[model samples]
Target: MTAATDGTRVTIIGVGPGDNGFLTLKGKQAIEEADLVAGFQTVLNVVIPFAKNAELCPMAYRDQEEVLDYAVGQVKEGKSLVVCAWGDLNVSAKELLDRVRRRVDHVDLVPGISSVQIAMSRSGISLEDVVFITLHRRDGKESALEELVYYLKDGRRNIILLPSPYDLMPAGIAAGVIEDGVPGDHRMTVYQRLTHDDEQSWSGSVSECAAITTDFSDLSIMI
Candidate 1:
């Protein structure tokens, strides 16, 4: 019988930039020994090779509820599990992890390199020079947009964008800033899937840049 039959340690793992290479040694070890791989199946697909013996959890929205429930159930049964995510330690991750923690006395956050940090590093921008807004809220907020516009107008601030998978990305954002009267030629960089082999980048401005029709499914944009 495998680890599932006897049960073992269950965790929510961070896969880091959708790259197996970015996975930490410990994280890889846990995944390899996990009884079940539970997470957004997109991320699951990306890291399947790492979880040689684990069962893949179906990709489901509101996976938090089911994933949390399953992990707790596994721990009770003594079977190990590892749930994956982009950053398994952020706010969204925290809220989800809290649910399982409430039920089980044991759980640990396995950290991974955040795509945001990777993008910032790749862009060569300091955290001090950037204003970050994670637009992935239930209710969107553009208040940051105003300040971003002002900063762009000043021509000195580097803007770091954590755009919601919902609203404007770097290209759209640049377009809006330009429409608001900021310099249309302001340089922008969109690091889609940073730290991954498929990672792509583009540089241009609101006034002259072409449409960005690429996959921003898991991405970070900098300007």
Candidate 2:
């Protein structure tokens, strides 16, 4: 255990796309030796085995500021801690970590397998054959989906989307495509929990998927 004033308050470790094995060796080591491990419930479950009697602090949706505050406080209190995240923490936790980074002098970010990387691997979709988009924003930005449809219809492009929780799901995307007047049933894939815990996949037309469940705790979409 060291103190944050020595440099940084938190060591952010990326557990890799829902699967612990995909986590970096350095990340595993950090968690194993950490005095405190903080993350969401899912990340906590996977890291628990390696945490050396570390206290856990689980953050729920959008509670990142609180988590970071606690982490910085702990570091000030001289506790060695590793903050867990999905796939590269820097990539997924960007919004908040950026703010936290300005407040702290040091943060160790560990990289891991990204969902897009895994989605490509699982679908055997050529890395060179697709465009990736993130539709998880609160604003129902149909512009992105509209543009994707344009490319898909041009028959010259393929897209992989990271859908927003329930507000902007694959089904809803399909609806958007139709609303945008893009016809023809496009093939789609949904990989739920990408790398762990009842991971599932469904390959079908975009229309059929609209009615399916959209509980994307950790998942991806391919179109």
**TM-score attained by model 1:** 0.77
Tell me the RMSD of model 1 versus the true structure: 5.3
lDDT of 2 by residue, 1-223 (tens): 7675577667777788866778778988888788888888877887787885788888887886787688778887888878777776544357545656776778767776677788889988786998767675545457766767777777666787877776777777777776776663767788877877677788887677766665544356555
List per-prediction Cα lDDT, in the order shown: 0.69, 0.73
Q: How much does each candidate deviate from the true structure in C-alpha RMSD?
A: 5.3, 3.6
Report the C-alpha lDDT of model 1 over 7-57, residue by residue, as the tens digit.
Answer: 334577777877778888878988888887877776787688877787777
Candidate 1 collision pairs = 7-78, 7-79, 8-78, 8-79, 8-80
- Provide the lDDT at 48 for model 2: 80
Question: Which candidate leads in lDDT?
Answer: 2
